[model samples]
Target: MLVAGCSHFAGRRPLLGYSDKGVQHADTAIVACAEQLQYVCGITGVNQISTWEKFNGGKTPWVRVLPGRQVIRMTLSNSRQLNRQDVIIDNVQAGHVYRIDVGSSGTLLTATYTDLGKLDSYTIHMPRFPLEPKAITASF
Candidate 1:
């Protein structure tokens, strides 16, 4: 069970349309779900992505796509309602981030798509391996 859990964790990847070597940071657009407003159940052209994390610490559900007209199918839900919406994002600019907000207004579920501007900053974590020299002994 422990090994299975570790394997599952290691196999997870972001639901990105382009390959890591093919995508340039400056030319990629990001779409993220607003965790406070709604939960994203799935994304189009990809497997269902989990938007929640342990202790609510999971990074928001986001995908990186080429800058262009993109159709995103989302299953959004709130405390009172659940909705499946097909959101058309047109003319997405490179280096920009878009956020989807779904909420209830007067008993009506509304989804708002907002462009949050360019991605400000990002961090990458890598494991470091130690390099040690073996002890050498000389005989007389």
Candidate 2:
């Protein structure tokens, strides 16, 4: 029984996940420039990972993006923000690091962009989803 109990430890570490192939963004990709993703600015893949490390306890199929060499996890859940049907994740400030709380079961994903040393900041808000959202702009 002891051996069976230890089975949980025999697998890949946490804070790691994989999305479908053909993700259409590298670092520095803006929403208007690339395929419109509802929740991520940059994602990690071959020749595209800005940085990816071990992050734990998030909903399945979340995308990890690197806006400024920092990791931000995008999650979607039923957890509402401010007791309303609005923001589930919030970035109160910019030019800093923020750890997204996955345990909250929230239902939105937000990313904040700021021109440092300036008074300009922009944030993107999107609904929570289990699959990587894609925007089709062209066809072959």
Candidate 3:
């Protein structure tokens, strides 16, 4: 019952062009979603949710769960070659629908939960170039 999705950057564009900045926008979106989930749903403990960047050579950022368990680990790294597209990011959810966005520089991982037939969603924003834990804030 694991859900997953991913996206990546392709082709070249001017450094300051819109296409080049798509990654940044995608990162922002992910961060926004995570915040919404945390604040709106009161989800405190986020166990291991896989992020796409881990596919590359990087240390996945993990969250500590109840007692002492790191559940979610998201990793990101730069590509070795200019033409080589780095593994942007991935979203993995167990028994839930995971909506993910893999941008050039970041990843947006979201999970939709169903409890007693009630639907709930949670999200996290992960950077693809370097693993840094940013504060999750609500989008609304």
Which one wins on TM-score?
1
Q: Estimate, for each residue in 1-140, the C-alpha lDDT of model 2 and write its tens digit.
A: 54433332221211222233353333222211112333322222212332232231222222322233333333333323321111122322222222232223344344333322212222322222333322222111
Better of 2 and 3 by TM-score: 2
TM-score of each: 0.58, 0.19, 0.17
Candidate 3 residue-wise lDDT, 26-108, digit = tens: 22211111223122211112332333232322222222112222222233222421111222223322222223222342343
Q: Whole-model lDDT for model 3 versus the true structure?
A: 0.24
Tens-digit lDDT track for model 1 on 18-119?
A: 545566656777776654524433344322323333321233255666777877666666567666666678888887777777766766666667997876
Each model's lDDT comes to 0.53, 0.27, 0.24
Model 2 TM-score, 2 decimals: 0.19
Give the poorly placed runs of model 3, Cα more than 4 Å off: 1-71, 80-94, 105-140
Worst 10 residues of 3 by lDDT: 7-16
Off by over 4 Å in 1: 1-13, 18-21, 37-42, 45-60, 105-108, 122-140
Best candidate according to lDDT: 1
